[model samples]
Each structure stands twice: as structure tokens, then as C-alpha cells.
Target chain A: MPNNRVVNKTKTVTDVMEEQTTVAPEATPAEEVIVDTAPAEMRYDTVDIDLTQSSETMLYSEVIDMGTSPDNYVGKIIKVHGQYMFFHDEMSENSYPTVVVLDATKCCATGLVFELEGDAGYPQEDQEFTVTGALDYPSSEDCPFPILKNAVITTE
Target chain B: MDKLAEYLQYPFVRYALIVGVLIALCSSLLGVPLVLKRFSFIGDGLSHVAFGAMCIATVLKLSNNMLLIMPVTIIGAVLILRTGTNTKIKGDAIIAMISVAALAFGYLIMNFSNTPNLAGDVCTTLFGSTSILTLSRADVWLCIIMSVLVLVIFVLFYHRIFAVTFDENFARATGMDTEKYNLLIAIITAVIIVLAMNLVGSLLISALIIFPAISAMRLFHNYFKVTVFSAIFAVICAFSGIIISILAGTPVGSTIVGVNVLAFAVCWSIGKLRGTAA
Candidate 1:
């Protein structure tokens, strides 16, 4: 609820193209809403682990760990800042929303996959933003990487 | 200091620092003997060979290139150290030939490769290293094991290596198998060179191997004293370099080497004042 961007509605990647026109924020379905429905134990009731507080090197290193060492991060309330990216895989017919953090060299990249809450509008590609959520692996077969579930996106 | 403490809590950062120290200790340990024997250029030559081997491994899409790289570099080191003296081509000439050839051939291979980030891949492997902080758990373990092996061998044969290093013909006349000791030094140097390729990139690895020994030699008179001082100086410079780079966002290889250069200057100044510099 703090600096959160109100989304138009629940628009999955497949339907995102058809609904290109910006529509007014509409009432979202109960099942689609994550912030309100996600268990209060992790995201809602607790203060998130703030990643933006650290330097870029520290932040990038931690993000790399989430991939190499996943169990340590799962189900934890987390907050991070990075450039937003959207990937469309034609062979798998899947679209993934991700945030990328750059290392000191600015050559190598470390990224985190994020899933927005229901009714959240998609941010523009490569836009810098802060996202907070509980780290989880969803049931979707398209993305094998751990994604931030019930996430709230705040664009700078 | 506070910022470094905060960064140190992360596992990856800790891993990087640990590997950095171990690799520095190993390289500095080998640095004294190499510099004394005039085999300092061997580190650079073998590193270029490693780059070529790595490029080949990259082209083949091997999951881990260490398997291909380690043996190739070892063979190259043995060949150079053993045959350089006996052959007409000679030590420096043969090393120079292999060095330039491997580097050019590696770049050419990389130019034709299908890697998505060709420039980035080559750049990371050529200059200040980016792989040190991004290493997997297996890399850390392997580095530790290899470093321990090098240290153990160095400690066990310290006397023999010292004899062969200071005066090879005298050592041979004294009934020591000089060639066997030379071979041991070559193998150990090759291992450190390969590990340093990850820490400082292939191009700058010689700095890691030679700078500390040279710096220590500026002040110390005895071989034992110089070797100990070099090892200590290298560890301090390298560890501080990592901490500074993490806080300052500088490249790791250059930062470590920069610290070494600064330390060398300071030692040289001290030696000049004492009238002891060689």
C-alpha cells in the first residue's frame, strides 16, 4: 500500500496485447489479488527484507545466491530495486517478468524473476523500479527460476 | 570498514574473499623462486596458453573447462621449463612464440564463436576479473584443495627447492636431482597460474606471481626472509584490495595489482634509504 502502483486489472501475458488501451482501475477478482490474499505470515504481517539499502555489489551478490542457493530465500519477504525486463519465449510460449541488477563491471548481469499481484499494470521495459514480495516457485512450467510472488512494484 | 563488514555477511562475498586470499598466498609463495630463476615470463606465457585452452573449451560447449585447461597448461609448463634450455629456440624465444600464438589464436577462435556476449566474455577473461565474485561452490572447493596441495609440496621440499633455485649446477654437483626439482616448481607454478586466471584474468596474472617477491626482495637480504615477507605482503595487499574494490566498485584484478604496485614502491623507497636495494 506504500507507494504502490494501482494496476488496471488482472491481465495475463497472453491477453496483454489485446488490452493495449489503458483502462481505468477496475475491481480485481479475489483469486487474482495477491497482497490481500497471501498469508499474513510473510508479506503482509511482516516488514520485508530491504535489499535497496545495500550497495550494488552486495545486492548483485545476494541475487546471484538466490539462484545458486534457492532454499535460503524461499518464502522470505523481500524488497529490491533493479531495471525491469520482460522476456517472451516463442518455443515455450511463455512470458517472464524479471528485474536485472548489474555488477561493478556493468558487463555481467544478475537477474530475479518477479510476478506481480493481481490487477497490476506492467511497467515499461527497462524501467527502474522497486519490487517487494515473498520469494516463491509457482506451479507454472514456463519459468523454472524462483519468482517473487504477491509482489508490489513501485516505479521511480 | 563498516561497509565491508556489512558486505562480508553475504556468502558469495565471503567465498570471493576466501578464494582471493588462498590464491594470493599460493602465487606469492611461488613468486620468489620464479623471479630468482629468471622464469618470471613463464607465468605470462602459460596464462596465454590457458586463455587459448579456455577458448577451445568454450567453443566445444563444455560444462566445465578446468578438465581441458589444467592438463594443457601443465604440459605446456613442463615442456617450456624442461626443453627451453636444451633447444636452440631457447627459453624466452620459445615462450614468446607460444604466448603470442596462443593469444592470437584464442582471439580468432572467440571471434568466430557463437557466444551471445563475445566481447564481454573475452573482456572478463582478459582484464580485471569478474569471475572471482561469481564463482560457484565447486570452484571454491577446488581452489582450496589445489592451494593446499601446492603449500604442502612447497613446505616438504623447501630445502631442495631453495638449493636448486639459488644454484642449480652446484645443487646437481652436490648429488641433488636438479631436473626433478625444476619439474616440481614448473607443475606448482602452472597450477597457481590457472587459478590466478580466474582471480586476476590471464593477462595480469604475472603481477600476482612476481610483484610480491620483487617487492620483498627490495628490502630483505636472506632468501627465507624475502620469501616470508613476500607471502605476508601479498596476502595483506590482496585482501585489502578485495575490501576496497567491493566498497569502491573497482575491478578486482587491477585493484589487487594496484595495491601490489603501491606496496612495491614503498618497499623500494625503504630499501633505497637503507642502501640495500638490488
Candidate 2:
């Protein structure tokens, strides 16, 4: 018989299957999904630019070079070094951490705005930091500059 | 130094040095006339107007801020320079009012924005910043073109510029278009001030146009010598300042201005020794 039934072998009607959740229940524990937890090199996006080794001021210049052509940096893991500032301007609202380099006047600062990979506690602001992340652009209205997403930050 | 060589290898560092040098040369040359005419306040007033225009450009989310900053500053310079006794406000009064108003308005507009780096923006606009190190290829080209144009105009009309600076009435009597020259200088001044905002920022920009001119005046008596010397002097100050800032992490604008001040002192001392000091 075509329908020789085993313990949960009844095939649902094609019409009914289309309306249900596509993921079928797995009977075996081995069928559980595992998240990809690879190292940065093992991941699809490779570290293209590593600024961690650069001197503090050189890092600022390199960041500016990256800022000029943000589109070219997409999905590329860039490691930048700078003084970190916790971007919790409106404490009640969501915010990202920033690594900053002052402008020519030494008054204004421009840097990579970064969203962390997980809900990790941030360090004290204004410390030297080396942040690694994939380049991401925000909506023009939100920020005119490019930001780093899924970033991992380290501090000295 | 090894550190200097390391920094120089980067393209951005080279760009900063070029722009800094060009700006030094142009501003120093023009600064002689402006300082002699007691019109150095024009630099400050025009720079403030530039800051206001920059704020508007930011609020509008314009891709290139120069589009707005350039025209507005030019217009302000013309009004401040050309509108002689016709306006109720005197030239100095107009400059004072406009500079203060524009600075206040700029601050007001910026305060209303949701920019995350509000303090940084204001400080960068008001004080000098380190943005010189971060210029794009396009910005570098624009600076080069503007510097070349300014240099060519100055070279072609060197004699006339000297004549006009000394006596407007005499220049007019000699069938020279003094008003036109004044307008040209005003527009140029406006452009230079705006460009300088990228160097010393809006507040300290006057140093570029004022210091080298005054310093060179102390060292040289002839107009041609003063012009040449100021250009050379400004370039040295700017060049050394940039290197020092890069090596030691000092504020670029202030360091350049400080170097100019130091140069002025040295020049003044030499002038005193030569009995040129009045």
C-alpha cells in the first residue's frame, strides 16, 4: 500500500501544506539548527583593511580615506583605531558607540559610528579603541556618514 | 624624521600639505592689502557668514556644503564691501552686526538639529579642526583650481592691486575700475575665507589672511617684496605647523597661527634692529 503508515508518516495534503509553516518538525535531536560561529577569516566577509597596527594619527587619515568612498567598503571588515566615545546622547533611546578623530580645527570630530554585534556593556568613553566591523550605510536622513555594523570593539 | 616620512607616505597627508600650502600662499598675498586697508575684519565677518551658510547646507542635507557656503559668503562680502555710505550702518558696523548675527544664527540652527555630534560640529565650525587630513580627491582638486585662479588674477593685476590698495580715488582717476577691483578682491576674500574654514575653521581663519601680511610688512618695505615674502612666510608657517601637528597631535589651525605669531615676533625684532619700527 502506498500509504503504509509508520509512527507519523501521514503526508499532509498539498493544499494544506502550502498554508502551514514550511518548517517540518524534526524527530531527531541531530536535526536542530546550528548558528554559524566562525572566526572573522572563516566568515564570508574578510578583513580587507586592518587599521589596528597604525599609529593613532595615521588611523584618523586612513578613516578619512575610507569615508570618501564608502560604497567600495561594503561587507568588508575594517579594523579602525581611535578614541572611543559612547554614543548615548539620548540615554532613553537607542544609540551606537563611536570612534572619533577631531577635524582640522581640533574642535569637531568625525568617525565611524558602530552598532555592536550583541548586547554587550560598553566601556567608559574617550578611551583608545580598536573597532572591527563590516561597513554599513545609514539612511541619509539618519546619518549622512557611513557606519560600521556588527562591530566588535576593544579598548586600552 | 622617521615619523614624518611614515605620515607622508599616505595620500591624505600629501593632500593636506598641498591644500595647506596653497591656502597659505593665496591668503598671505591678499592679506597684505586687506591688513593695510584696515579691512581684516572682513575675513572674520565673511567666515561667520560662511558658518551660517554651512549650517543651512547641513540642515538641507546637501551632498557638498561648498555649494551653499560659496555663494552666500560671496554675497555677504559684496554687501559688506560695496554698499558704501548708502546703508545706514557703516562698514565696520555692518561687519560687526553680520558676524555676530550669523554666528548666533548658525549656532541656533545647529542646536535645533538632531545631529549626534552637535558639540563637535559647533566646535569645528567655531575653532580650528583636524579635518585637513581627511580631504577627498574632489576637495583637493577644487582647492587646487581655486588657488590657481586666485594666483593668476593676482599676478595679472599686481600693479593695479597695489595702486588700488594705496588710493582708491587715485586708482579711479587713472581710469582703472577701482570699484570693480574692489569687488573682485571682495569676492576673492569671501572665497578664501570659506576655503580657510577647512583649515583653521571659521573663527581663526582671519589669522591666515592677517598674520603673514603683517609679519612680512615688518620685514620688507616694497609692495612686491612684501607680497613675495608674505607668501613664502605663510607657506613656511603652514608647512611647519602641519608637520608639528601631525607629529605631536596639536591643533592644526592654532599651531599654524601660533607659528605665524612667532614669525611676526621674529620679523618685528629684526625690524626694530634695522630702525624700521615706528
Candidate 3:
């Protein structure tokens, strides 16, 4: 029975080899094609800011701290699912979009401002959305909040 | 109504409602026995212990503060119950001592320690300022599981609890283990108080436990009726309080307690009117 099984395996391998030989030549050239250059800005689809399971309040706090600190979270991808908020700066007359993350108790909130890549219309205030972007600490006087640059927003 | 609907869309808000309701139910379940047994202040005492444990957990940067808080509170509960009978110091005095000490120590730790947002932390811990709205899904699950356990235990031992509460000497004389039941009550109360601290803060936990029981007592004569009414009243107050706090941007814990106070007032007035009519 073992010998018959081995023989059957060999026959299958041979059949596969024969089929591959016919297809290899056609597939080889296509497979050999290489990219000429890498893109300038690295695009990240999403970095899950999970708040549903595990220790979310602690994790959110850590994310807020990391985003605010002088450390280079710049260009690092982040995906946060949280409540959307907007701060209208009366002084600069500029509107800043922020995503607020609440702790387990909901008493404290950490607000993260994000800059959308294009002119995607801002979501309604206090709506929960999943936002993905590269972290940026803009030194501009008008807006000094930790921001997600080139962000994509989607309803949760 | 539109704004309420909008807020409900947020997962955190929904989570708060679930946890708040569960915590309210558990607290009210234990509240009846605690009030009847004259252990009303025990919830407040145990909550302070939990608060101290929370402060320590924070200082040590524990991932889940409940780990430290639960065991400490259970231990505190056991000690309080055990010492209630024989201690030279009265039970209320002992509870007050422990409660104040824990609060003071917790504050001291928060103040001297390198804990960030000390004022905010203290405020939230003591008054439950919007903490209910910040519940994670994990917290909701924990609250659900614990609340279920509490309810099951209460149901399973309902008669024993009633017997012990009304006439402990008679219960002990009738071959029932009064001490064991008392211990169980203390442990359950501690657990409920600890869970309730997140909803109403340490200072207001007694109100969470006491108000429902007392309000139900004002209207109901039978123990079962009172217990049922307390649970219903607690749930309604908790639900309404959470919604009001979310809409009005008030402190979640205090608002719930405020609702409880209002319920108590209404019950008191009803009882008075009924008494006069009778």
C-alpha cells in the first residue's frame, strides 16, 4: 500500500512537471519583470488602532503620548478608530480636525488632529470614524497639535 | 433626540450604557441586604480600598488595575466583616477610618508620585466624571460577566440572605451557617462596590447601594418586592443618568447619584402620602 502510494505520488509529480514545463516559458518572462524605482512616499493602508478588545484605554493613552512627544513618530503610519471632533481656532480662523480617544472610564479624552490627504469633506462632529495616516508634528505656529498627515477617514 | 441618537452611534457611549446598567443592577441587588444588615457604609469603605488599590496600580503602571483592586477590596471586606462583631472599635468607626485613610493615601500617592494628570485622575476616581462613557469593550464584557455572576449568586442564595439579614441568631440556631453567608455577602458587596466605583466614584458608591434599597423600602413591605423594585429603580436611574450626562455634558457618576437622589425623594413623598391616606 505504501509502495502504491509512493508510485501514485511520483505519477502526480511527473504530470505536474509536464504541465509546468508547458506553462513555464510563458510565465517566466512575466515573472522576471522588475520594478524600476521605489515610490517617494511610503503608503500604509492601515495601522489598526484597536479599541474593541484588550487594554484599549491604556493603549490609547500610549498612542497619544507617543504622538505628542518629541520622538520621531514622524512618517510612522497610524490607524485610529475613535470619535471625531473639530476645533475651530478663533485666533487663526483655521479649523483643526481631531479624533478624540477616551479611556476606559470615558472621563478623560486625548484628541489627535489629522490632515486629510485630499479635500475629503470633514465628517460630522463627534462621529466615530477609522482614520489612517502618517504621524507628523507640524511646527507651524497656526496649528501646533500632533497631526496625522495625508490621512484617510472612513466611518466605523 | 437627534443628538441622543448621534451619541448612541459611538461605541463608547453604548459601552457606558451597558456597563452602567449592569453595575447599577449588581449594586442594587447587594444594596438590599447591606442596608437591612446595617452594613450600608461598607460599600463606601470597600470602594475607598479599591481606589487606593487603583492608585497603587497606576503608580506601578499595571495593565489592568482591577487585578490589584479586586483582591485588596476582598481582603478589606473580609476584615471589615470579621472585625465587625468583636472589635473594640465600632463598625462604622472602623469603616470610616479605613475609608479616610485609603482616600488620603490614594491622594498622597497621586500627589507625590509622578502620576500625570493628578487632578483629573483624582476627580474621575472620586466623582466618576465621564468615566462611564470611556468604557472599552473589554470593560463591558467584564462588567457583564461579573454582574451575571453577582445576580446568579444572589438568586441562588436568596432565602439564605433573607434569613441571615432578618434574624441571624435564628438562622444560626436553625443549623444554617450564618458566618459563611455573611462572608459571602461581604465578598459580593466588595466586588459590587469595586465595580460600582467606576460608575459612581468611591465617595458615591454607598449612595449607589443605599439609595435603591432605601427607595424601594419606602414603598414595598415584602423583601422580594423591595428587591425587585430596587433593581428596576436602579436600572432606570442609571440609564436615565447616563443619557442625561451624555446630553448635558455633566459628570457621569454624580448625575447617576443625582438621579438616585431624585428617585429617593419621589419614593419618600409617595410613602408619606400613602401613610397619610392609610
Model 1 lDDT tens row, B1-278: 77777778777788888899999998998999999999999999999999999899999888999999999999989989877978888999989999999999999998877886787788778764457877888999999999999999999999999999899999999999999999999999889999988888999999998999999999998999999999999999989988877787777888889999999999999999999897
Instruction: Please write out the lDDT profile of model 3 over residues B46-149, one tens digit for every residue.
Output: 99988898898888888998999999999999988888777898789889888899988987887766754687788788887666655666887998999999
Q: What is the lDDT of residue B36 in candidate 2?
A: 79
Query: For this target, which candidate reaches the highest DockQ against the unseen true structure?
Result: 1
In angstroms, give how far residue B111 of model 1 lies from its true place.
4.0
State how far residue B78 of model 1 sits from its true place (Å).
1.6
* DockQ of all models, two decimals each: 0.33, 0.29, 0.04
**Model 1 - which docking category?**
acceptable
Q: In terms of lDDT, which candidate is stronger, 2 or 3?
A: 2
- Per-model TM-score on C-alpha atoms: 0.86, 0.77, 0.69
The per-residue C-alpha lDDT of model 3 at residue A33 equals: 22
Model 1 over residues A23-133: C-alpha lDDT tens digits? Answer: 221322334432222232334566345677766656776787877777777898888888866654445555567788876667767678777665565556676777778
- Tens digits of per-residue lDDT, candidate 2, B1-278, equal 87678778777889999999999899998999998778989999999999999988887778999999999999999999876436877889999999999999988898777777788777777765667877888999999999999999999988888999999898899899888888889999998888888888898889999989888888788888889999999999999988887776777777888898998899999989998754
- The alpha-carbon RMSD values of the candidates against the true structure, listed in the order shown, are 5.5, 10.7, 17.9
Stronger candidate by DockQ (1 vs 2)? 1
Cα-based lDDT at residue B27, candidate 2: 95
